[model samples]
Target chain A: MSTKNSEAGEGKERAGDVIVETVARLMVPFIQLFALYVIIHGAGGPGGGFQGGVIFGASFVLLVIAFGIVNAGDRFPEGANTAFMSLGVYIYAGVGLLCIIFSLGAAQFLNYGFIPLTTHFEENRALGMDLVEIGIGITVMAVVTSIFFNLAWKREPEEGGEEE
Target chain B: MIPSLDLVLLFLIVAIAIAAITVRDLLSAIMLLCAYSFLMAVIWVEMHAVDVAFTEAAVGAGASTAFLIAALSRTTRWEKK
Candidate 1:
């Protein structure tokens, strides 16, 4: 029974390998575009920061699986990943800081009325929400993508044994 | 709550989760886990949490599955039972 199971597993792996290749090819561009759309359209829709971020992260994960971890790492080097992660956090935190500096008597942090950007409260609220969502999307996307890469890439030891 | 479609989706989710947990081959288990996540995403959508459903679909179904498969490639698939 175990032998039969092993054979079945092998067959499934082979099928998955082929399907992964095809799906990866078809998914990359569409995933990226859809992620962007989610981020932009989130203001008036059910989608928002976290959802868009995950979608963005999924694109990189797909690329890694379809090709190889090494190829994915090469494309998105360690230095670049660090930069993206930092940039995303900065964007998110920066928005809150800006609101504090520009707005007075606002209820709290991220309160759009404090900024006084527009005379209309609704417009200001919308703009503020957009900024926050964008920030969240950026941070979530970069952080999750980095996590995926770290898990996927495994280095082999020189002595012909598994490393850790 | 009594709709037939909801019942079918609920059953599908349970079946996928069982397959994911019971599969001897780690790779197959991981793949089934992905399917389970996709089904859970559908459930979340049905429950009207669209944002949560979207995240579940992308991260749980997509990124997590790829990560598991990649990690599996570098390790043994069969587990002693």
Candidate 2:
């Protein structure tokens, strides 16, 4: 359960002073809130899924830096990351598939207007963009967190090893 | 709107880059790289590329810096002579 970066060895080296930890804990919520705002407002503003997603991932990374890897894993378990990673791509492709299913007299894919949920064509397009953006955000967040974790920690080989 | 300010920032970024490569200690080099990324982000913001600036700051300066620090922790700190 105790990763090298989490327990006695490296944990002691990385753990910041109490003040830094408190500041990091207090700061993460606001950072995440701002990241969400950036994602939702991306259509009109200078923000989007990738930027917001990186910001969200950075917040957890901040937690890891200030506290340790274990705290971060505890807060957001490693198993959940795999789920989010695939689920994000699924959402993106699923939305595209949905557009094809509706077709709406169009032969093209990802035709957001063809979904026909909103009265205005622009609104439907906006909604589709939102969904796609959310998917992008999810994928970016999970991939980044996964990448950082991989770089930061050495993984234990799973049981029933298949390789020679 | 000051062209001189942009020029100054550009020079500072170049200086930081040189320092990042020249620094002997890996930890200081990583810190210098973070500083470089931040200055680069500021330059992007000055050019009105807010989205690019935002991503550069978060991913480059924020996350990558921490990742490098973690990498340093598990590895040797000094560069080979």
Candidate 3:
């Protein structure tokens, strides 16, 4: 955040005790923990990639609300967002490519058994599903946060403008 | 879905939707829409789709409302008559 804005916001925050900020600070960590739990628990539960990712993204949105956009952006820079977004797809596609390599150019694509992560075929399938869900979760999280940032930190309506 | 609870939730959702559309103050409309989303989430939960309810509460009630409020801050709150 710019020094001026930070100073002004801090002054206002100090003057009023900022009950919302305090509550948010106390709650956000638990919310993020739950999101991670949802992501990791997708295999056996109702949670999955998309929902977990959105939940993770909502944490950042909450941060943006409690602090300013600049503060939130500082925590998750644009470059970091782009990197994570691409990394997710890379992890997903890389797993498929690994499957191909395991097949030695003769087996079907995404053949999880060929990779031999586990002794049982079903276990390998389960592992592959976990990896894929993680990839989807990462991609969704970054994309959602990016969209919110883009929509939020733009030009504002001027005085007497038709803002509504 | 329990018929009585489902009916009540659906009714509340419709009422909130109407109030959201008719309110001249954009902020209150946005709040009403959030309430509408919460009710929709409950309805989804009653239907045994816990995953969908989770999503509606997270995206519809939470993030979307925050985004709308952020946008509202940069614009006028009152609608043009």
True contacts kept of each: 0.62, 0.62, 0.50
lDDT of 1 by residue, A88-135 (tens): 778777777777777654536666655567888888888877887888
Q: Give the per-residue lDDT of model 2 (tens digit) for A2-106.
A: 454454344444567889899998999999999898888898888888888888888878877777665566667678998998888998898898888887656
Which candidate has the highest TM-score of all?
Answer: 2
Q: What is the lDDT of residue A141 in candidate 2?
A: 89
lDDT of 3 at A23: 80
Tens digits of per-residue lDDT, candidate 2, B1-81, equal 569989999999999999999989999999999999999999999988888898899888988898888778767899998
* Residue lDDT tens for model 3, A71-121: 566687889999989998998888888888888978566777677898888
Clashing pairs in 2: none
Give the winner by lDDT.
Answer: 2
TM-scores for all candidates: the values are 0.80, 0.88, 0.84
Please give the interface root mean square deviation for model 1, in Å: 3.9
Instruction: Write out the backbone clash pairs for model 3.
Output: none
Off by over 4 Å in 2: A1-9, A12-16, A155-164
Candidate 1 on B1-81: residue-level lDDT in tens?
336878999999888888878889998899889888998888888878887888788778877887787578557899778
